[model samples]
Structure formats: C-alpha cells, structure tokens
Target: MIRVRVVTSRRLHVASLSTCTTPDSLLAYGSRILHCPDPHKKVALTFECQNRWKSEALPVYTGSLWGSDEAPGLPARGPRPELLAPKKMPSMKQLQTQASIPVIMLHALAHIELGAIDNYWDTLVRFDPVKFQLPRDFYDDFLTVAGDEARHFQMVDNRLRELGSEYGALPATRALLEHAANTAADLAARIAIVPLVQEARGLDSGDRLVHRMKSMGDKESAKVVEQIVWEERNHVRCGMKWFQHLAKVQKREQDQVAYFQELVLQFFPDGLPGPFDVEARQEANMGTEWYESLESKVAHPSGVKLEKRGDTQSASVAAFAASKKKVILAGSVWPERTSSAAGVRSADIIQVLQERGYQVLCVSPSRLNDHTSKLQEEQGVRCIQADANTDIFQKLLLETMPQLVVFDRFIAEEMYGWQAKKYSPEALRVLDLQDVHFIRRAREFAVKKQGLNFKETLDGEQLDIDPVEKIAIRELASIHRSDLTLYVSDFERDLLVSRFQVPDMNLHRCDFFYPAIDVSKLNSFNDRRHIAFIGSFKHSPNVDAVEWAKKHIMPVYRNLGGDAEVHIYGSYGETKRFVKLNDPKQGFFMKGFAPDAHETLSQYRLSIAPLRFGAGIKGKIADSWFVGTPCVSTSIGAEGMSLDGLQWGGTIADTPDTFASEMLHLYNDEARWDVAHQAGVAACSARYDASRNGDSLMERLERTMVEKRELREKNWMGRILWSENYRATEYMSRYIHAKNDGVNNGVK
Candidate 1:
C-alpha cells in the first residue's frame, strides 16, 4: 500500500510510488499528479511521472482510459502563493518602467510556469484519448513542454532569490489556467487556446521583456528570459503543427486563416493586444498578414465608438471641429520626440493642415507613447486609435464623413482607401507616396550589386523580381486611384508620370518642409568640430552608410591628419547590431539615438550622407542645412533636391576616395567650410523654407478637395482599381466583420 506523510510548505513527504503506484497508462499517471495535495508536490510528481513514462516504467495509453468520460475532474492542490483577481496583476509596461515591479513580474511569470506544467499534465489526462487519435509525437511534444516549463520555473525562481525576493513574496492570478480550462475536454480547442493563442502571446511580449531587462542593467536575468523566449518558439511551433494536423483531419485545410481566426475569436473575444513581436511569430509560422487580418476581424466587429480625449488642445479642437469641415489624416505613423525623417514630415504636414482650418484628426493604430501623447496634447491634433485594417476604421470614416482623407503611403491606401471611398465617397482620397518605393527598391538592388558599376545595372534596366514588381504595381495602382498623389521630390514626380505612366493630372509636387531656422540660435561654423551622421539605423541604407564610412572613409580621413571623428547618431532597434563596428582607434564612434536630431547636428561642423541608394530628399543632408552645417553626400543622397550645382551648400560625391577628399578639404580649409556652410543656408532657404513649402502643400490639399470629382474622372485607372478590385476586399472585410459580430453575440 502507498503511504502519504504529512507535508509542510517547505518540504515534500511522499512514499516511493514506483512499487505501489503502478500507473498503467498516461491518464493514470496524470490523475496521480493532478490530484497531488500540494502545489510543489504536484510539480514534483509531474516530473517524476514524466521521467518514469519516458523510461517506460509507466506505460503509454495505446487504446483508451477504461472510463475516460467518467474520469474525475482536475483536483485541488495545496496552495500558499495566494491567487488574486486579474485586476491585481501588474502590466508589462509598468513592470518595465519601475524597478520594484520586475520582481513582482518575475514572481508572476514563475506562477505562470507552474500553472503551465500543470496545464500540460491536465490536458493529457482529462481529454478522451481515442477521440483525438493523437500520434505518439503529440505526447512527446507535451511532455517536452512540461519539462521546459519546469526548468523555466527554476530559472525565474533562482532570479527572484538573486533579487532578495522569493516566489511567494507576491500574489499572482489564475488567469492562465482559467483560460486553459475553456477547452479542458476538447483537444483542438486546447491546442488553439493554449499554445497558438496563449504561448504565442508570450512570444509577442518576449523581446520587450528582454529589452527592458537589459535597459535595467540586469543582463544575467535578461539572458535567462531571452533563452526562454527562444525555446518557447518550439512550443508554439508544436501547437501550430498539431493544430494544422487536426484541421486537415477535419477538412478545414482550405480556410486555415479563417478557422484559426474563428477559434481565437471564440476564446478571446476582444482580440489580442499589440504591438506584437512580428519577428518571433513569423519564426513560429504565424505570419503577420494571417494574424493581423484576424486582429482586425475580432477587435472591431460591428463598429467602434470614437472617444475624443478631453484634454487641453484635443478638447479645443473637438469643440472647433464640431462646427468646421473635418479632414481625417489616417496613417499608422505617429510623431515622436526622437522621430524618423518620415515622422517629422508627417508632423509638419498635419500641423499645416490644422492651421489651414481643416480640423485634422490624425488616426493612428494605437496610442504610441508619452512622446506622441505629449505631441498631440501640444499640437491640438487629436489622434484616434482606429487601425485602418479594422471594421472600426470603416465606421470611423462613416461617422466622421470627412471632406478629405490622406493615406500616408501606398500600403496605408491599400489597407483603408477603399473603405474611405465606400463610406465617405465624397471625401477626396490623397495618396502621399513620400517618394516612390519601387524606385527606391530598384535603386537599392542596383546599389547592393555594387562590384559592378550601378550605372550599368540601374540605367534602363529592371530587377525582374517580385518585390520590385509588386511595389511597382501596387504603388502605381495607388497613384491611379487617388485624386492627388503627393511627391516630395520633383525627380520622383516626373519618374511616376514618365516611367510608370501615372497621369500627370493626378500628381502633385510638394517638397519636404524643413522647419524655419532661428538665425539667432544658430551654432557658428567656428564653434563646431567633428563630422556627424544622423539617420535612424533602423533604415537599411543608413546602416550601410555607417558600415561603409567606418571601413572606407574613416581610416583615410584620420590618416590624412584630420583629428575630428565621424560620430554616428540614430535611433537603434538593436544596438548590438552596430556595436561590433565601434572602434575608437579608427576615429569612428557609434552614438546611439539622439534626443534631438537637430540639436545634435548643430554641434557638428559637418555631416556625411554616403547613401548609395534611396529615394526622395535625404533628411541628413536637408536637416544638416537647417542646423547650420554642410554635408558631403553621394548623388543618391543629394538626389531630388536641385542642389546639384549649389555653391553654398553640400557637395555630392560617388566614390569613397572623392568623398574622403571632400571631407578633408572642408575640414582643413576654413574658407571652403564657410562657403559650403553658407551654401547649405542658401539651399535651406531655397528648397525647404517651411513658409513656402508648407503653404504650397496646404494650397494643393485645398485644391484637390475642391476639384476631387474632375480629378477622379480624368484618371480612368482610378475608377477601375476603386471599383473592380476594391469589390473583393470590401466584401471580404464585411464577411469577417459579420463573423466577428456573431462571435461576440454568441459568447456566454
């Protein structure tokens, strides 16, 4: 007979089960573990049973449990770490921001692991064995998941001890197990809800947790968390594989996305909260398009009610807009304190739109961050979190019924332009290409194939790949479909009309608007020293430029007795990607992310933008001029701005030797520096003076709205894309919306 001794919180007391507790099948072993009285003892029993099962000491279920349906439900276990309601839990954001909160978060994650171990065990035991007809690998996958979870618990528990905390020092919620309980009897539902949905959420939040831990200077803890994140991908992949296998068995192969989405909606009615980790999810075989499409379906089923924040500036705008004509600027981009070049452009244009009495509502996907919130507070531009991919966006368009809707780029237009046309048909759709993406891709392809002269590959040649072809087709279609397409460069404007044969009648030229320089606050050329490179390293061209400069230009500049270093500045996604390139011996420094890009440029004597390939005006070159510095860039870098022959501004150089020579000349000779500096000032005034460019773009915006019908009529392709192709997308969106609504109404 088996003997069970009295157990305490700190000690496990159980007789050796190998002799008396002869579990003949997987379910009996699970029953023994699940019914264990203490939580710690339960986990111990789980591991022991799993080991025994692996060694064949306990047998695998070949047929079925004798009385599976009559098998007892999940039993209660002794618990000292108290369970609180979901409201008591701390959010990941709060945990990231505060020092003390991470300890609590670690405690919470530890609890999650314990529960996950129990969950996997409970799944194998509670579900009827023969119904699933699960292959042997299914049991292996779950056992491996259980083992990993046990190890994860140890890792986090060890981390807590390192932090002078214990696992039970804080309370955690039972939400994980509660979610798992929804499909306790069904195998497919368990796989969908647990691994695909729940574990997938872990992958989404993993990078952020690692980034936070690193930022908090807990590298050891970060390493452990990162390893867990990497390992968890297999767990998610297992879920997907089993889910697909089950789907195939059920003849649901043709509608995998729809079926998976339906299950997610059934389990999680309100949709998954994001910004999701697209990279990790893609590795698990759940691509962004699949889930992102589902997100739209579930998040906003029928429609969404717009909530205008009752704040200082947004409130004032709300009162004003109640009476005036509204213009909705729907885009995913939001203004940041440390913004990209495109972000800065959008901010300036929106400001101008508001000033022109259009009462602009900047619709972004989500409330970005404090920086963006503060910007909206100050600018009087209301930012609504209505994602363009959702039915809520269509409702937003219908409710507002603006006279004009501006798409940030071709992708944005493709996502929501049809909805804008359907709901607010009178609203003039303006597609802001922001420079042709296809041309940029083509140029980048030519540049990447650099051993051979790019001129040969680029001039009158084609890429013949899907990327270039897709961008060309999509962008050209967006251009043809819009009443007006805004181009930042004259070169791109002419290229679209001439090369792509986009109707010139629909194209509008609006040069990038640079903020007016305060002459009084300008850093004098004499006061500055080193050369600076300012561009977000998130962009491929910027990273390439920095790497090129470090290898080719920096050594030459230093060898020639130029003491000044080339400092690289940008918002870095992963600083490690560039950290290896940093060598002080070469007079090359990686200054990660500037708080104010303009202020950083102001301190530099000069700037370099050796961008071999990109489209539109280079912000580094344009912004350098605004901050009273000159730039030496490649022809691609200085393209689009008619600054080819400027005497006072930047010099364009193609090769590294020419570029290095120009840098040395400008640095050593003060007169030549002054000439280039003054030329930059002249170029800033000539091309990017905000008063001129901003006013012109504003006027164009007004004119397009005034003549929307005539402009739409002139472009026949616009009618074809908006009508024929749009019908499919429009109907599909409606079907998803209806299905999501049904899910919402059906929930208990």
Candidate 2:
C-alpha cells in the first residue's frame, strides 16, 4: 500500500491505497490530482474525498522515490506539489495530437446532437397535434437524449484533457457539422439518419483507436476511451429507438427505407466504402434488414429511371436536374386568373413545375393585379411586373436566365420565349395554350344570329377572324419554335394538330388542376330553389352570358312563378347593367366579388353558365363542380372540358326556353338537383384531382425534357449549329452591353 498527499490551490487531501505501493503507483495516483479551478475556462476534471484520513494510519508515502518533496524553490507555505506525475503524463505535443480527433469529434457531435434535439422540440411545438398525434413522452425522450449527448460530450472532453489536449486546440474538419447544418429542416431525419447512420460509422474507428492506443502502451488513454465507446453505444441506441418509434407512429413502410437511401445517395452521391460499423448498429437495435434495405436503396433508388431528350444523352440528366440551390423563375402573370388566359395558363404550369423542383421566377405585365401580387408574396415566388417588350425585360431575363422558359400566350412571343431562345439558348422553352382565341371569337359572332349551330357559327366573321386567327397562328408557331408546348387537354392537343396544324411531336397535354377543395365543406341541398351565374364580369363571354340570360332566361323563370333568385357574382361588378341588375326588388341579386369562389358557389342551388363562346375548360363549370353545384351550360360553355355525352350535372341547351325550363326544373326539383350535384362532384374529383393531374403533368414534362436533351445529344451537328447561333447571340448581347456602358459613361 502507498500513502499520498494531493495538493490543490484551495485544499490538500490524503489518498491511502491498498495495492499501489511502487514509485510508479504513487506518481500515477498524483497524476489524478487537479488544480482547484480548471486551467482552461471551458471545462475541467476534479476529484474530492468526503472524509480526511490520518497520515500515520496510511501506508508509507513514496513521494521521495518519484520526485524530491523538499527540493529547491519550495513554497514557504508547504513542500512543492507535483502538477502532473511523469508516469501518467506523455509529451505535451504528442498527447495533444493524440487527443485532438476525439475532442473535436465530441464538440462537433454535441453541437450537432443538441441542435437536432432542439429542432425536434421546435417541430413538435409547431406540429398540429391532431394531424401528427405525437405522444406526451416524445418531447421527454428528446430531452433525455439531449442530456445523454451532453454527458457524452463532457466525458469525451475529459478524456481529451487527460491526453494533454483540450477542445478548440485541434484543427478539425467541419464536414460533419456542415452536413448537420445543411439538413436542419428535418430534425428526426438528422437524428435518425445522420448521427445514427453517419456518426455511428465512427464507432468502429473509435474502437480501433482504443485498441491501437492500448497496444502502444497508453493503457490510461485506452481506459478513458472505453467509457466513450460504452456511452456512444447508448447514444446511438437512443437515435435508433426514436427513429423506429417515428417510423411506427407515422406508419412509414419500407418506402421510408427507400427514401432514406435516396437521401443518402443525394448527400453522398460519390459513394465512399469502408469505415462502416455493423456491431454498433446491432448494439443500437438497428436490424440487419434495415441496413441491407438502406444499402440496396443507396445503390439503386426506386423509380429513378432517366429518359434522354435533346442533348441530354450527351450530358447526364444529373447535370440538368434542378439543384437544391436557389432557383430563378422568370415569366409573365403567375397565379392570376385574369381575362388573359395566358395568366392562368402560366400560373398553373409554374405552380406544378415549382412543386416538382423549379424555383419560379414570375414576371407579370403589371403588379396592380391583387391575385398575382398576393401569390408572389405569400408563396415565396419572385414576381417582376415589367414590360416584356422592353430592354428591361431582356435585362431581367438575362440576369436570371432560368433553366426553363414557360410562355403563357403569344402576346410575349417575340419578347419572352422567342427572344430568350434567340438570346439564351441554354434555357428550355415551353409554351402553354389556354385556348384557341380565333375559334372563341369566331363562335361568339356566329352564335348572335343562329339559335345553335356549332359548325355554321364561323361562316361570316372574316375580319374579326383575321386578327384573332393571326395571333393564334403566331402563338402556335411559337409553340413549334419552343422545346415543348403544354396544352390543357388532349382535346386541345387534337384540335391544335387538326385545326392549327401543330406537329404532334411538339405538343404535350397537361390538364388544368383546380385548387384543392374539401367536399365535406359543401352544403348538401335538400330542396333546390335558386339559379346562379358566376364569372369574372370583366370576361367578355361571361358578360355576354349574363346579358343573354337576363333577356332570354329571366322572363321564363319569372313566368314559371316559382321563388327562384338569379345571382350574378364576380370581380368588377361596377358595370351599369350589373348595377341595374342588383335591384333586390326584381328578384335579381348581383353579389359583387366573392372572397372565395368555392365558398360562395357552395351556397348556390344551381349554376347557370350561358357562355356565348369560350375555348378551353370553363372556370364557372369547374367551380360549380368543386362545390357540388349542378351546372347548366350551353355546348360552347362546356367546350374542351371532356364532359361530352357524360351527362353534365345540368343540361346543355342553346335555345332560351329550353335553357330557362331546365334551370327552373332543376332548381324546383330537389331529387333532380341532388343527383346532378353528386354527378358533378364525381366529374370534378375524377377529372381534376391534382394528385393525378400533377403526377401525369410532371411525368410528361420530364419525358419532354429528356427527349429534347437526347435529340440534341444524338445530333451533334445540330447542337454545334445551335451553339454557333448561341455564340452569335452572345456577341450581339456583348455589343449591346458595350453600347450601354459607353452611353452611361458618355463615351459616344
């Protein structure tokens, strides 16, 4: 046995051991003594005894054998105490180098783990309790895990100090911490995947370090690290348990394993093999099945088929895939359902593409429109309301240079798509046709004289046909010029191919997806009694519909003598006819500008859309169906909606008497209205479910892009010609830039 006195700045303590008796034993015991306060301000290790022991009762002190107690320069207060014993202390630089890795790993791990824990807590706070159904113990478990990580960090740090190094002393790579920061959006993902999946890989390496250090005779260092390995096992186990709990609670099947594998490939696409820890995974309760599944998924992500298009075969699709980095969306009129069908067309495509991957740049003609401005601000989309005809628009296009250029209508044909193609050939150009304007206007004139004639309607409108026809032809030409043309319906595609002579290779069909509506929010009609006409009053066709309805249908409804009100509601209700129609005394109600169409439409008994002429799917019909409001419309009103022969919720009549009688019958009869409403809802759900439409549209876009890429890649001569043209455009742009700079500097 040996006796030793441990001196600190605050007090002196005595140690009596039964087995340690050599000079080396006494020195090793002395090495455990630390100063009263930590040398470094961050953290320190200290030891203290509860009771004091008499020196006479202890074994002989071996201080003189290790080092002289009463040497020169001894303090007057007492004999000099050893700061550190030679047996336990290695060379300072050597110890620091040895401890640097684990200490840095611990500090970084603590930051990452705690951040993940806090993020989970915050997410839980924001999560809708009803939607997620998280348990009470979820948060408690997170806190416990955080506590364990903190303890692990402190323990590893202490071991680091024993090896003559401290935290912040080593230059450690921030790759792990950086990855953790990058994936902060999903904390459960970080905890379950990163620390458990990534950091758990460190376990084997840590074990190897311990074994190697012990073999090198650094037994004290090895013992300290043994504690780290034991604690890390539990820490990783915590991650595994929570991860499994989340999977079970969320009902995530094997698909999540696939998703996790994809995420790993995305983050670590280059694949680094080895340094994987199977033992730690087993200890952490991670099954071999999950690991194997993850491995397979990483090797091959599900549904990751690539289709080549244009020059894409020459360059991998990976090169063209949307980077998670910032995206720039440059276009005109987004999220606005204005009279310009282009506005609606561009908005729909932009919304769909954005959901898939695009960072949208929404360029509108004007910022005065509330719908466009509101969508831009709230949806985090960039909106620029600049004249596409001007240099400013070109400058903006050049500055952003979006990967995809989506054109709504032909108005900006020469300015946006064509000009962008002429300037930035790298951008894939897309054209969206809301409808054929020529056909719409031709039908509008033809319907005025004839009661109902679909083919004969376009016979006598030549001059009116020319301007509209020219625009449509130019727009279609622009579509041909573009890489891809997106049409709202397959019907529209056929019409374009047959009527406008658009090539089949150029056109792709993508149907309109109405805003998602909850069916339960609709008011079920027990007894139908009212007829409603809803549309934006600014639209000429809708305005014409209302005027016709007032003159032809209203009188018949009045004659029937049933209590039924005709309601006209939409934006821009200030027109004189609308103002005159608002007289409640006449059973006509012009409810101006509904805050929400679905909300307002749900209350209506029956919907009447007597559209004189319109191309593409009618919004009034769609809105009515969304709220289970049975709609009565003329044939032109249901144009391109694909509702032909599939009994529309209401009758399609051209004659005033038949239209009026059908509306009256539907309004008066409850059973007829209920059947129609159900049919309409079914039509809406089956046709316009965004999930289905969105998936199909995305697939088509992907296919088109791939096809275009492959085409360019396969045709190297064509690509070279295209590149030469692009370079010429670049030279022109440089000339313009030089001219602008000269003007600004007054060089001219």
Candidate 3:
C-alpha cells in the first residue's frame, strides 16, 4: 500500500524522525520525504535525497528484509488542508465562476505536485534494485522526476500565496494517492498505472489548463502551468522507458504491450479519451499503437458480452443466428434518424435488410444517444455500441454468423473490414459510399482556401495536394476491397469508374427502400406558403449553406420583391450563428429540428440551398421533393439528383443574383410552380420507389453472396490489402484479449 494522504503541519527535523529505520540509505531519504508533514520540507528533502545519491553518501539497498516499515506506504500528514474523497473535491466548472478561481486552481495543482513528489519517492523506497536486477539510472531517473515534482509544487504554492491565498486554502482529493496504493505491490503495474496513465493524463489536462489561463489573460500563471506540462513529458517518457526495461528484465519484452494493456484496463477501464495532445505525447514516447487498443471502450453496448452462456445454447443465441440469414451493419456513428439524413439512410438500410428476411444488427463505435437507444430498444433492430478491432465484436461475429456484412461508410470499412474477414471469411463484404466522403472534403478545402466553386474545384489539381487526397486513397482502397459497394448516386459511381478505374461490376447503385412522398397525400402548390431551406445543421454543407443564404442569397431575394417569407428547418440547429441569423423582422426564421421532414417541408412553396461546397446529392433537395416543395439549389446541391433532359423540381442557380431571380419567378408564377411541384413528387417517387429499388438492392446483395468468392478472387488488390490490413488490426485486437491468453503469448 504505497498510499499518500497528507495534511499540512510544521516541518520536521531529520534527526528527530524515527520512521526510516535505516536513516543513511537512498531508501531511507526517499521514505523520509513521504513522512514529512510540510510540503516545502518534502520538496527540500527530495533535492537533498537526489544530491546525497549523486555524492555516494546514500547507497541503493539490495533487499528489504531488514525493514517493511521503511516504506509504510501511509505517508505522514498534518491538519490544515482537509483531505476529501474524489467526489467531494471542487470541480473545474465550479472553480471557474469564483473570484477565488486562481487560488483554488493553484492550490489544487500544488496538491497534485505534492502527491507526485511522494509517489516518486515511494517508488524509490518500495522496490529493491538488486532483487529486480535494475540499473542505477532506474533510481537516478525517478530521483530526477521526484525533484521536478518538488519544484513544481513550490512554483504552484508561490503562485497561490501571491493570489491572496495559501496552499491550505482549498481541500484536496486522495484519488492520486489511491491510484498508487492500488498498484503498490506490482512494480510493473504501478509504473504503468501511475506514470503512463495518470501522468500522461495530467500532461493532456495541463495543456488545456495552460490555454485556459492564457485565454483568461493570466499569462504568468499560464507560463507556470506550461512549464510543468513541458517538464512532465519527460516524466511520462521515464515511465515508458522503465516499463519496457522492467518488462525486458522480467523476460516479458515480447508481451510488453499486452501486459501494459491488461494493467491499464484492470485499473482504469473507461479509457483515456484524450482530445489527445499528440505532439507532446509523441515527444514523450507515449505514442504507441497499443495505447489506443489498451484504452479502447470495447465492451458490448449492453455491457453483458462477458457473461457466461448456459451449457445448452441459449434460445436467444440460437434464434439470433438460427435462420442462417443475418447481416451486420457497422458505422462510426450510431443512427439517429431525427438528426441527420445519414441517420435516415442508416435506418433505411437496416429496414431494407430486415424486410429481405435477414436478421439485422448494427455495430458502431459511438455512444448510445436518445435516438439510437430508442431504435435499439423499440425498433427491433439491435444496435451494439462496439469498436471494430475487439474480441467482443469478434465473438459477436462468430455468434451471429452474418451472411452479409455491410459497412455504411468507407471509414467503417477501413476499421472493421479486415476483422470481419478474419472472423467470418464467407460473409459478403459491402462498402456503401454514401456519397463519396472525399468529394465533399476536397470541395470544402477548395472553397475555404481558394474560394473556388464545386465545378472549378473538380477540374483543378487541388486534390493532388489537399489533405483530403489522403482520405481519397483510403476511400478508393475500401471500394476495391469490397465484394460489392453501394452508391446512392449514378454520377458518383461513374466518376469513380472513369477517374479511378474502379470496376463497374463491383459497384451497385442501390437507392433502396427509403420513405418517399405518398403522391396522393402531398400538399398542392396552391396550398403551400413561404420559401424554405431544410437540412440537418450537423452536416457541414447545411451550416455553410445557411450562412451563405443569410449573408448573400436571402437579402437579395427580399430586395427582389420576393413576397414569401423564408423559413429554415433542420435538426440540431442550436448553433449560436444559427440563433443570430433568426431575425423575424428580416423575414428569416430558423424553424429548427423538424420532427417530420415531409410534413414540415410541405408547408413551403420552395426551398433554397445556396450550398457553396458539398459532395453528396443533397438530402435537403430530396426531402424538399418528397414534400412537393420546389427547391432552387446551387449546382453542387442539385448534383446527382438531376437528369440530362428531365426538369429539376425548381432550378439550379450557382450565383446570388441568378438564385434570387429563379426563386422569385417560381414563387410568383402559379402555373410554373405547379409544374415544378409535380416534378419534385415525380423525382422522389422515381428515385425511391420502394418496390423497385428495395427488391433490386436485396437481389444485388443475394447475388453478391453467391459470387463472393469469384468477385474477391478477381480483385487482386483486395487480397494484397487484406494481408497488410489484417496484420495491423489483428495485433490491435489481440491486446484486448491478451490477459485471457496469458501475458507471455504476445500478439499470438
């Protein structure tokens, strides 16, 4: 129990202290630091301990047989600063609003530094260097870290005093002390938990605190915090270094990641989800492949995957895969139909699969939200919150034995495709392009950087150097690796074929079973009022379009005597910019979070999508058509939804004046509006004709299952990639299961 619980008191003299039985060795000096009740004295003792070790006045011990009391693990304390449980400590949010924020923050930081000093010293005394076959630098590096921790404490304490407060002004938590105590007996585990996990987390938090201080105009305080953060990287590096050294000495070098993974999970399970300071961590040597694997939240959504099944196969498991027709749909996000069009598309695929007699289950590496939880609990489609490269998901694969495995996005395919292959080799793999991600990203970069239009961006050489070009490489590989890939747009399909030379047979255009307008139920052109723009605010294109409409398009429409008031409708529109744009006097209303897309859209005469940059065919345009709302959209917005000779619902306008002109004409002319309204209804029906596209999608999937082997055999690139990708994903997932496999097994 290498624990640290402290209280402030008068500093003690070394000769009077009786805790260190052997008062001359390095272990005795280290133990004496922990026994001191005063933080300043602890800091002073830490430096003295380091100096004594350097001067050969205090030698490292060979064994602890003479004294267990030398490192009693319970550090001494005084009375002023009351110790509290972790839950009782003041939150950062609470501290931020107070005048005493600087005092509380500085004091709290000092508390951590003080604890670090104790923990470093405890490590020095608790482990025998000779018995562990350790070098002198193991003792040296930790002593250096201890001195730094002491200096950090003194620095923070000085800042606190200058703020009209002292170190005991705030209460502190024993969480850090408890962490070290929990792993005290296991040397490797203690090093992994304390330094790698806790110290690395402190480094992450320190970066943010430094930024926060600077933003609040406290640059001096920021400098102090920044200095601590910079120095702390070496502390993290020391942890990584010694953990490797200790593991090698123990003949566990081959399974270092595996052993480290188990220790982290056993102690801290939710994982260190960092808005990670990658640069600092990379410099610290904390950037390793296994860190992410060790930190992954890999349990089943229900948190019951580890539970034992009865001797007889459970009825649920039997029914789960009994039909011999199951499909697994994996994605980066859980489906939320009310939030984004992607959500609706996700729900549509699941519904389509289930209707075709396949048992459907959705797997995603996202947290369960209200919408997704409802879908899982009530919608009869099982949605599991699981990461791809995990044994939990691998076990799920074997249990479900899905005949078809569909990845709704290229990113999902990149994550789960290889794992699915390793576990279920016979499953037909499908990647749904969902309107090429890189297409949108490249257009976005061009628009933001070069102020270029979608057409111009497409023709230019910008994709060659754009960051999204790297994404384009991954996307293309995902397409090539799949037995079949689904595309919502023919334009996107042909573009990939012509540009990347993707095989046409390997791709399928599946509009698939999406809800369309009940033509008989649609509102008439004469019945509707107001102009509108409808899109989920979560989509970058929609947010940009709203801004563009406000700053450029809507003002022109009003000046041109467009009588109809413009209304904006979408989900998740709580953005501050959106709130600022909702000026009723200007006749622009942000009618946010439409529950029923069709019904809400049906009230508008026409919609405007002044989208400057986007990739996918606009779901807003499709929704507009479904509700019989004619929409005048930019070319990028109307792309893939238009035909060569056929009329679009309203018109395509790329410029501000053109958009205003076209919108005004459609709103005023009743006969023209009627024709446009009918075109919209026709487009929705033609594109999403459930019986036609639904059967076609299912038929294509069924056919691919039969031809899976033949299709994969012809795709030599996929075979080559599977070999490379398998190795990468295999070792990652193996980390999660390593403890069960035994520590010495390594990647195997």
TM-score top scorer = 1
lDDT of all predictions, in order shown? 0.71, 0.54, 0.74
Off by over 4 Å in 3: 1-315, 367-369, 458-465, 512-516, 725-727, 735-748
Judge candidate 1 at residue 499 and give its lDDT: 65
lDDT of 1: 0.71
Model 3, position 522, has a per-residue lDDT of: 77
lDDT, model 3, position 15: 32
lDDT of 3 by residue, 397-509 (tens): 88888888899787677667877887889999899877887787778877886776655754423344356665687788888888999988777787888778788999998
Q: Write the per-residue lDDT of candidate 2 for residues 1-748, one digit (tens) a residue.
A: 4556675542224344332332122122223211112222111111111011122222212333322121112111111111233354445465456555445444444334333333332332223223335454554444344344434546555666665654445333333224434554454465555556655655646666665566567665665555445455656766665665556666774465554555566665533333234435544555333443222112333444432123532232223233442233344334565433345545666677778877765554433244555665666455555433335456655555556676665434433554576656677677666665556655665666345554355233232455345445545555656676777655557766776556677666666576666767778785334677777764668878888888777788778764678888876564334667675765778887776777777888888888767677787787788888998888777666656456577667777887888887888778888888888887887777777888887777667666776644554433443464633323443444454334434455
What are the clash counts of all predictions, listed in order?
3, 22, 1
Give the Cα-based TM-score of candidate 3 against the true structure: 0.63
TM per model? Answer: 0.67, 0.50, 0.63
Tens digit of per-residue lDDT, candidate 1, span 193-291 = 888877888987776677677767887777677767767887888888888887887788788667888888887766766655554665575654456
| Residue pairs in clash, model 3 | 7-78
Predicted structure 2: clash tally: 22
